[model samples]
Target: MMFNIELKDVGKSYGDNEVLRDIDFSVDKGSFTAIVGKSGCGKSTLLRVIAKLEETSKGTLTFSGEGSKDPKIRIMFQDDRLIPWKNILSNISIGAVNKAAAKESLQEVGLIDKEKDWPDQLSGGQKQRIALARALASNPDILLFDEPLGALDALTRMEMQNLIEELWQQQQFTSLLVTHDVTEAVTLANRVIVIDKGTIQLDEKIDLPRPRERDEKFTYYEKKILNQILGG
Candidate 1:
């Protein structure tokens, strides 16, 4: 019962289109994992299936842990998905039990000052922070990210990455990120999974120390994953 999530022979399909097949993995509690692959390679589909946003067509998806029969799971996306009409505070408070919890989450993202500001007034990166705050407000046991930083400019993206890593280190929530950027995957995840043609091609453990650099070892793993994805 130590694992937070497990998939056994999982499969997903839309009629004749098979998006994921024979997927098998177990996510350790409080671990960070990244899934990467080319466009249309079903990486996102795997996350969706695990998140129950899309039901699997075959096999079992199990949730187990101490008091995890009905675990709290949250997902963040690249779109930021904020409600334009609501102010920053209210947006993150959507599922929160109280304004205090929402405020704490907002503060965690370093956006407490923007509480009363509308979503339109905030920049793209700020909006995404609010999105992350909203996801964190629920105190999720598992957090899934579907390319949440894809829309940001380079510097902002790196900033968000740092913020995310800091928060993850502090909170120790189980995380799964689906990203097209191998560097992003290598930088954040303790383990990186490469998917091709709807199945996992390489599952590499990133033994590099945290606050990881794009050092030689980092580049080696990055190139290995890239080669796997590109069929090099």
Candidate 2:
């Protein structure tokens, strides 16, 4: 097994306004990890730091394994961020080198036939699927998700979750998800990390089996994380 990320004493600040401090963690290659924290608790900042979008104020960060060095890291956000005027094919193919690759990725995300449809023609989940296809088109070795499924209704959100899990299993890409939904975190990640006050509050592995049902153990982990988020 290869190590995907090694972040030690990582901290971030913006002009003396500290947003993250003393963060440390290791993520293994091809693993899915979920980071959960309340709003403004620096969860998103931590994700950005890991993605190298924001330079770390202090600490050492390292990436290893295949594609780990100069890895193609991509991020998916709560908003689909699709261009309204662009057709679906044009939108998902933004990073693709050519049409074939774009069409392949679009099919991978189950939206092949929607290529000619406009963004407004799609539903929330469909737009998210397009965003996912766009990210996949880049062939990223690492995927960072900032609650991309947060905007959908319960049924749609669950459907997207399944889709993400399926895609991850097929690609075996190292992934990190930042979400406020504890259940969602527990349901998807092999490990659940709780961030509080810009620091890691808890790091627990999900030993439950895959295709995880909302069983007792799953519920227990969800409650445990929820309690921490509630400051219990």
Candidate 3:
């Protein structure tokens, strides 16, 4: 019960296609974990299984936290996926019941003033910020990210990374990120798990401390994971 989430012998398959196999991991409450793998390696499918967007073909997932039978969960993805027709504030408010909390979430993402603007009116980074604010508005105890920064430019991506770390530090939520970037994985997570060919290849702890500088300091773990993915 100490763990917020646990996967026991989890597996997923679409007809004959096996996406994940014997996946087993437990995420402690308030921990940040990153999952990395090559394209078509079932990374997204694994995340979807956690989200319950897709049912597991085998095994069980257990969740416990905050004295509630079910923990509140939310997911952020690469697309930002905002409603183009709805203005920024409305998008969040519609999804989140409390309008005041939606406003505060926008403020947390530094988008309080753009509440009335359409999604198309914002830049890519700003749009992603809105998406993040919407996710946070619900105050989910469990948050999942699927390459949320994959589409951003370098500078903006770094900014978003900082935002994520800052928010995680402030809110202490259990976070799971699925990313292809090894550097991003090392920079953001307390633990990094690498997947290959529908199985776990490596699950390593990132010993580096938070507010981590993306300098040569993280090269050791980054290269370790990179080599794992490259089959070196």
Candidate 4:
């Protein structure tokens, strides 16, 4: 079967500063993949490169199968990135303004009632929910999440994690998440890619079932991933 995303010997640099080197990977259709690494390891940079927000210094990226023309890609970031001037509905719509689609996306994130409220008036969790709704409203073929829950508190982070998992299952969209949280990656991803010093150190299958609990088994896998990332 053909893969949905393919990156062959990809690399990137800023003048003399090389940020990524000879990276390679592929993602199957409907798969959820996570990239984790320490700060400045080029995890987010890889996501940006894949999303075409940043051009690669070398190599090729290929998107296959249906929806390849436009790809309907969406990105959610660490910050909510919502406009303070826009209300929740407008923020979610982002000028698409399909009332039915906006309503459905907001309801999916449990923010349907806050449509009239300004972004500044929502809680951190709600702001993130709006971000999620915005991403979903686009009906993306692939969702690129760059530390989307990094700013939330523990409880909110857990909630958002569950929400993302649920949404992924419901939407069946291919996803690539760039996160520093090992447990979060384990919980949400079917495969985890570990990058270090501008290189991919490990690309391992999670093999864990969906709705994974943070029990001993999950903890073990988390430790193993941490060790791989840290070169332990």
lDDT tens string, model 1, 159-191? 999999999999988899999999999999999
TM-score for each predicted model, relative to the true structure: 0.97, 0.96, 0.96, 0.96
The clash count of every prediction, one per candidate, is 0, 0, 0, 0
Candidate 2 wrongly placed segments (more than 4 Å): 1-3
Higher-TM-score candidate among 1 and 2? 1
Best by TM-score: 1
State each model's CA lDDT, in order. 0.92, 0.91, 0.91, 0.89
What residue pairs clash in candidate 2, if any at all? Answer: none
lDDT (C-alpha) at residue 122 in model 2? 93
**What lDDT would candidate 1 get against the real structure?**
0.92
Deviation of model 2 at 198, angstroms: 0.5
Residue 206 of model 2, lDDT score:
93
Error of 4 at 81 (Å): 1.0
